[model samples]
Target: MILSTTPTLEGKPIQQYMGIVTAETIIGANVIKDIFAGLRDFFGGRSGTYERVLQEAKDYAMQELMEKARLAGANAVVGVDLDFETIGANGSMLMVIASGTAVRI
Candidate 1:
């Protein structure tokens, strides 16, 4: 299904609104990754481990969002929005949320 951050898709007119659909994913930080990230923070460099984890989480959330839209009888999702936040005690977990308007075009 097509996913767009804009309210409308170019050339394809929306035929029906299937209401809002959302997906959420929560990932816990690995201890080894946290240690490496801490070292990277102190040394001033990027943390590949954390980056990969975040990317994976985002991909999972987006996939779930697409599934939800499909279940809602939508061929596309418009006005897509993604949010990321740290959750859990001591911010040990990362939360990713994907939301959009399900539509048939």
Candidate 2:
């Protein structure tokens, strides 16, 4: 399905509004990854481990969003938005949420 951050897709007219769809994913940092991230923080460098984890979570959330849209009989999702937050004790968990309006084009 097509996914766009804009309200409407160019060239393709929206045929139906299938309501809003949302998906969420939460991931926790492993102890080893946290250790490496802490070392990187001390060395003033980017944490590749954390970056990979965040990217994976975001991808999973987006996939879920697309699945929900498809289940709603939508071929596209418009006005897509992604939100990220850190939760759990000591902010050890990362939460990614994908939301959009399911639409038929």
Candidate 3:
């Protein structure tokens, strides 16, 4: 399925508006990995652990959102929005949410 932040895909007309579709997930941080992340932060480099987790979360959420769109008979998702939130102790929990308007071309 096609997904974009813009309201419409280039060279494709939006034929039907199928409302909003969303998906979310909560992930917990690994204790040992968190300790290593602290060290990485001090050293001032990207944290692979966090990046990997978020990337996975984004992929999962997008897949789910796309499935929803598919169920709605949509060929694409427009105005897509992705969100991340940290919750629980030590900010171990990550919430990934994706939403968009399902549309048919």
Candidate 2, overall lDDT?
0.98
Error of 3 at 25 (Å): 1.4
Q: Report the Cα lDDT for residue 56, model 1.
A: 93
Q: Across residues 24-85, which tens digit of lDDT does each residue of candidate 2 receive? A: 99999989999999999999989999999999999999999999999999999999999999
> Total clashing residue pairs per candidate?
0, 0, 0
lDDT of 1: 0.97
Worst 10 residues of 1 by lDDT: 27-36
TM-score of 2: 0.98
Model 3, 39-88: lDDT tens digits are: 99999999999899888888899999999999999999999999999989
Q: Poorest 10 consecutive residues of model 3 by lDDT?
A: 24-33
Clashing pairs for predicted structure model 1, backbone only: none
- Give the clash total for candidate 1: 0
Reference-based lDDT, each prediction: 0.97, 0.98, 0.92
Per-residue lDDT of 1-105 in model 1, one digit per residue for the tens? 999999999899999999999999999998999999999999998999999999999999999999999999999999999999999899999999999999999
Ranking by lDDT: 2, 1, 3
56, model 1: CA deviation in Å? 0.7
Q: How many residue pairs clash in model 2?
A: 0
